[model samples]
Target: MVLKCSPIQLAHSVLLTLGIIWLTPVWAAQEIRVGAAHFPPYTVRPERGADTGLLSKLLNALNQLQSDYRFVLVPSSIPRRVRDFERGRVDMMMFENPAWGWQELSYTAVDMGLEDAEVFVARQNPDRAQRYFDDLSGKRLALFSGYHYAFAGFNSAPKFLTNTFSATLTYSHESNLLMVLRGRADIALMTRSNLIDIQRYDPKVKSQIMVSERVDQVYRHYALLRLDAPIKSQEFAQMLNNLRDSGQLRAIFGPYQIDVVAM
Candidate 1:
């Protein structure tokens, strides 16, 4: 049958098809994969069906805002993680302070909304060995392998001794704390909030541990994003800033005793 169709009929059919396409659930599903390390009290491994700490809370909030994103724990090594993200093996990853000097690596600084402070934790034993950086010269000092110092240049003093003192480096803050508790390592450097969280989980260790000294006060943590991420870094930063201003950020972290550092 040969029949003439009106222009309006063709236009209406096209609009209906377009509307159906736009209404599909797949159109709203934006897949953004994130990588993280197992840093206790912030991010931890799910053991025996346990929830990973504060990071879990943060992820929950993120999920509320986003529908199609998931975070996976990457090993605590910055170099390897960066390589993965750069090569498009992973979509995004969070970092405290990345050493990547490349302009292509876009990052959104979260400001952590917490105070920047470092503490030197050691065992409480006067006879064994009091607090002495010199004593730590030949021994090993442990820090989280993948973490970076936000205020690296602020502390001008050399971390290691030159000639008479040489120390080995160990990774993993949790392991480092264990070493200190067991008297394996002379001292372990950690953040104050992290120490508090650890103590909460293991109260017996609190009696044996002591915060020797405040190393630095401006060691704020930040969330570094990849430049090629589907979400804009600057926009994320603004959203975080707005979250802080609205008091929602503080509320989210306050229960966990994490203070928010205003941007």
Candidate 2:
């Protein structure tokens, strides 16, 4: 006859199985996949062979913390990038200003300690440049796909353009600059820092670019992580905060001429 198992013995076996399942290595190793655009100086492709700008240094600092990170460069659009992140296709991304409507998606945002000034880049011709926004009253203005602008005092104007300006709006920082060079669009909106970075990578675009107006100032260059990421989002936020406190951020961005701002 077979011996009957005791209740305590059966309980011990159950606990052992549960413990093994909980202690599995797969539960411990987590990865974060970040999405970004080739908005040079802020973020760019490694194949470009130019400086990765502040984003590169920021990523390096994050890597130094030994965190697992994967980067994906989205083409010409931030809303698309956000869509990818929401679907769990990507774990995080960079440089999302708080104004973007993704705060509820459970992504943690960290201050990369950089500020950006928004400006309109128009043709150097006085009449043409002055008519940029005016002529676009019923037309489209090119803006970075997911960028936001406060418009300072022009918030009530009918033609105060931005990504949210209208469905007719078309945007591509590189393409927009190219358009200005070719006189295709009325105006292109961009950040001063980004313009400088783009010029550094492609000198040919420089002559066609000039700041038409300093529209608004905003804190730029922050890191974002999916709220449901396997690793704690708070931990990542804290790591960035520590980097800022220890001056590591300063050291990393100093060479790029970026100024850090607290969020």
Candidate 3:
């Protein structure tokens, strides 16, 4: 079985190997930092080895789809998002609404074709059933620290909210819901999506909470990108569209009891 190749044959084999390597596409991976707030179901601050949320799942899919761009989540808060974006500490903000105050900033908006709603949540008090959310006067409320609501005339100033409406400001939806559950607050304004997710994660919490019919606003979420971001709005939209067409979105959000809206 012993065989020897000529010098010319060996040279040809080496050249073929070099040609294949040269023709291979070698891409420089670009890092895309996506700002993340404490929006449950969409994003929860990632743990050491656990990426637990919708945004994490979506970002993982995006990373897998393209080798050129590596999407990542950067920590931020509702009040500090502007500072994060303006300082170039983060490249983009995900699942944002224009009304959240990025209008004056240099950024582009891309409609994500996903939506959620802000609604009122209260404790499951049988005695006060059907009479809890009837009036807003003289009622204690728990609300997110820096969110503008339709009922507040979209005024999210902490001083105005605490002084005018006597609202208790919380940094997290879980805290707001907990306040309502313990009767510490009359009602808490929360996202319908978050409520759904909380119920999914802890079924017992569902029995402790009751939701109201009064919806604050329906949110059509978007990705707000800086003007100097590595990716443009349209290009980002195209990548999302590819995910939608391939049914990846449904696979990711469906199990969480969320419906993927058509783009």
Candidate 4:
């Protein structure tokens, strides 16, 4: 056992070990946890089963395109997402905008080149004249509790909105729209794409509500990656672009009336 090992033997052993490590692929696939809220036509969490929506479709295509990373959804509410991101509960957020109160957060911003508009929805009463979105002064608005709207001066506080314009803020878009139909609220602001999807699936929604010619804002969407996220910002964009090139992007949104702003 006291015999000296030759330099060549030692070198071969080291090389063999290195080769084994190289072949073994020791690291697990990097997990990219995406923060998802119940934003219909984008991400919808169903009552009985798995979540389904546009964002869900996009993530599926992205997952199919690679093996280095596995994307998974991390459930979050509209108000709770920022805290989750800061606490590292989620690694990224899709279909986001900086103006949506995310300015102070530490994250990489990647322009998605996607656009969706939020418009006013009210019950169909052909006898009534067209109502504009410029004023919320006397309206009993059915607003989403955790959302920021351009017309509301980007305010999400129920009390402030209530004092300003008789608003009934709730979490569900369906509920908001229902309030409008049942004479509980004067109007509900919702995404144009969601309206299309809802109208297609539910004839009740189609027969009762009328989409306003008034729109609050056309969102130029983006992907926000936390500072500690596994993938680089540019790399995530590349994955998205790959989906764009493959016709998957348009396919997912085209039927819903959501057009891709970029390829």
Give the top-scoring candidate (TM-score): 4
Deviation (Å) of 99 in candidate 3 = 0.7
Q: What are the clashing pairs of model 3?
A: none
Q: Which clashing pairs does model 1 show? A: 113-260, 113-261, 114-261
Q: Give the poorly placed runs of model 4, Cα more than 4 Å off.
A: 1-26, 46-49, 132-134
Model 1 lDDT, residue 48, Cα: 31
Q: Quantify all predictions' global Cα lDDT against the true fold.
A: 0.59, 0.62, 0.84, 0.84
> Each prediction's TM-score against the native?
0.69, 0.64, 0.85, 0.87
Writing each residue's lDDT as its tens digit, candidate 1 over 149-248 gives 3333322223422122232234456778888888777677786667877787888888887675546444555666665667766655666676678777
Q: TM-score of predicted model 3?
A: 0.85
Q: Model 1, residue 193: displacement in angstroms?
A: 2.6
Better of 2 and 3 by lDDT: 3
lDDT tens digits by residue: candidate 4, 32-103: 999988889788873324888777788888889998998988788788888888899999988888888897
Per-structure clash totals for the candidates: 3, 2, 0, 0
**lDDT winner, 1 or 3:** 3
Cα distance off (Å), candidate 1, residue 11: 19
- For candidate 2, list the clashing residue pairs, or say none: 106-227, 113-260
Q: How many backbone clashes does candidate 3 have?
A: 0
Q: Can you give the lDDT of residue 77 in candidate 2?
A: 40
